[model samples]
Target chain A: GQQVMQIPQYQHVQEGEDFTTYCNSSTTLSNIQWYKQRPGGHPVFLIQLVKSGEVKKQKRLTFQFGEAKKNSSLHITATQTTDVGTYFCAGGLQAGTALIFGKGTTLSVSS
Target chain B: DTAVSQTPKYLVTQMGNDKSIKCEQNLGHDTMYWYKQDSKKFLKIMFSYNNKELIINETVPNRFSPKSPDKAHLNLHINSLELGDSAVYFCASSHRQSYQETQYFGPGTRLLVL
Candidate 1:
């Protein structure tokens, strides 16, 4: 069985501050996907990293995959009120296998 | 059009009652999954169906059953639900051609068992 753990289960930041969440897996993953769930909403696909040491950026959000493929990170630069949500990191073990999700990091931004 | 859609956005039932939630994905993905999000927003995979065949079955309770009548639809039926079953159930779908593919999720069904 694969297990994913996320750090800083909860985070409270002032508007315009930065935030980051780290995810680690007990087993090496083939790929890792990040999702964001707004309050009272479903989890929306954010990004997916397949290659080792891959880094991708979307607007103010940056995603990085560790070289070992066992860890990942999501960093948000200059967070805003709209950034309030729970960010989850899900690890893919193999082809056709289901994703094992981390507990997720809930972000609260105060303006 | 919604890529993935679920029925009964909210469900409230008494303990020991049985209820079903329906999910459909027009994305034409081959793999569908059921995930439970607890009060803390921790998402856990409950089951997965690939091409209408059961593929991933997590350590879910026997009272919960999932069925995929077709590639585009997956339904979850919970029997004799308990108070602990109060959580949000999400249905998601992925291509499954590769493990790295993105998954599309429905709005989610909030179930409250009293």
Candidate 2:
């Protein structure tokens, strides 16, 4: 069975600080997707990485995919109170397969 | 308009009762999925349907049955619900059944079994 693992099950940071969450998969993934869930809200899709060693940025957030396609990372610069939420990483094995989501990293930012 | 929607944003029932959660997608996606998020926030996929056909069925209990009435609707029925069944259930849809596709999730249905 394929499994996706995320580190820092919980992270608390102050405003203007940086935060990062790492994800690793037990098996090589065809693609990886990132999601964010705010308090009492549903998960929202943020970005996806399919190519190896790929790096994508969205404003102050940066996403990186490992060369082996088995790991990924999300980094946020100068975190704000609006950035408080749980970040999840989901890995897909192949076409038509359900994604395996890692235990999300919950981020809490205090001003 | 909501891309994906589910009925009964919250459900509270006693153990041994039966309940159903309904999901509909207006994104014209061929694939729909149901995932459960436990208290620990571990998200696990329970079932998936593509074009009204069952595609992925995980190792979930038989008491948990998923019905796909049409390509745009997927419903989940739980029988003899237990206390352990308390969790947030989410419905999501993707443009296709491919792994590379991004999924759009609906506001989850929170179920609590007493």
Candidate 3:
């Protein structure tokens, strides 16, 4: 069974603080994607990393893929209230296979 | 204007009853998927349809069936639903490559079975 687990199931931070979430897989991943789901909303695609040891950034958000391709991390700088949401990491194992998602880290930012 | 959409954003039903959740995508993608999110917020893929053909069927119960009338539509029907079946169901679409492709999710349907 392919299991993707994330740490810090819940996090609360003040505005202007930084936040980080880590994702570890029981097995190697072919690729991994990051998604953000706002309260009462659908999950939106953020980014995807395919090659090992890959890192991608979008504005204040940074994503890193481990050399083994079995771990990942998402770091957000200067978090704001708008960043309050659940962040999920989904891993794709093989060709034609569906993505397996982790339990996500719920971020709550207070102003 | 939604890339993916599901009808009846919220559903409440009694145990043993049957219900259906309809999903549609306008992104012109060839692959569609159904995912279940539990109370703990863990998302699991239950089914996938490629080109309107059943491709991946996870360990989901046989009582839960998915219907793909076309490439852009994938409907999920649960028969004799139980209390444990209560969860948020999401519909997503992506390219058929299975990797390097991003999945777009719809506003999930929150099902409450009593």
Candidate 4:
């Protein structure tokens, strides 16, 4: 069985500060996807990484995939109230298989 | 139009009762999935369907059964629901065309068994 684990299960940061969440998988993944769930809302897809040592940026957010394809990270710069939500990293074991999601890192930002 | 839609957004019923949640996707995707999110928000896959065919069943309880009327509709029926069955269930759809499968999720149905 494949498993994905995330660090800092809970994070509380003030506005203008930075935040980062790390994800590791028990087995090598073919691809990884990131999702965000706002309070009382469904999970929304954000980005996906396939190549090893790949880095993608979306405005104030940055995503990185490990060289081994077993780990990933999400970093947010100058967090805002809109950034409060749970970030999940899902690892794809093989083609056409269900993704294994991590416990997720819940981000809380206070002004 | 909503890409993925679900019926009965909120359900409150007593234990031992039977209930069903319905899901439909308009994206014309080949694959649809059912996932459960517990109080801790840990998402786990329960079942998957491809082109109206059951493709994956992830050790879910026998009381829970999923049916696909067509490629666009997938429904879940729960019998003899227990207190532990209370959770938010989400239905998602994805195209099986490429390696990076981007899943489109619908607003989850919250079920509470008393």
- Top DockQ model: 2
The residue pairs in collision within model 1 are none
**Alpha carbon deviation, residue B39, candidate 1 (Å):** 0.6
lDDT of 3 at B107: 92
Kindly list the per-residue Cα lDDT of model 3 for residues B23-108, writing each as its tens digit. Answer: 99999999999999999888888998999999999999999999999999999999999999999999999966475689989999
Per-model fnat list: 0.88, 0.95, 0.88, 0.59
Clashing pairs in 2: none
Candidate 3 CAPRI classification by DockQ: medium
lDDT of 2 by residue, A37-106 (tens): 9989999999999999999999999999999999999999999999999999999998657888999999
The C-alpha lDDT values of all candidates are 0.93, 0.95, 0.93, 0.94
User: Where does the lowest 10-residue lDDT sum fall in candidate 4 chain B?
Assistant: B95-104
Docking class of 1: medium
Which 10-residue window in model 4 chain A sums to the lowest lDDT?
A92-101
Off by over 4 Å in 3: none
Which regions of candidate 4 fall more than 4 Å away from where they truly are? B97-99
DockQ of each: 0.78, 0.88, 0.79, 0.66
Instruction: Give a tens-digit lDDT track for model 3, residues A28-47.
Output: 99999999999877789999
Q: Which residue runs does candidate 2 get wrong by more than 4 Å?
A: none
Q: For each candidate, what TM-score against the reference?
A: 0.97, 0.98, 0.96, 0.98
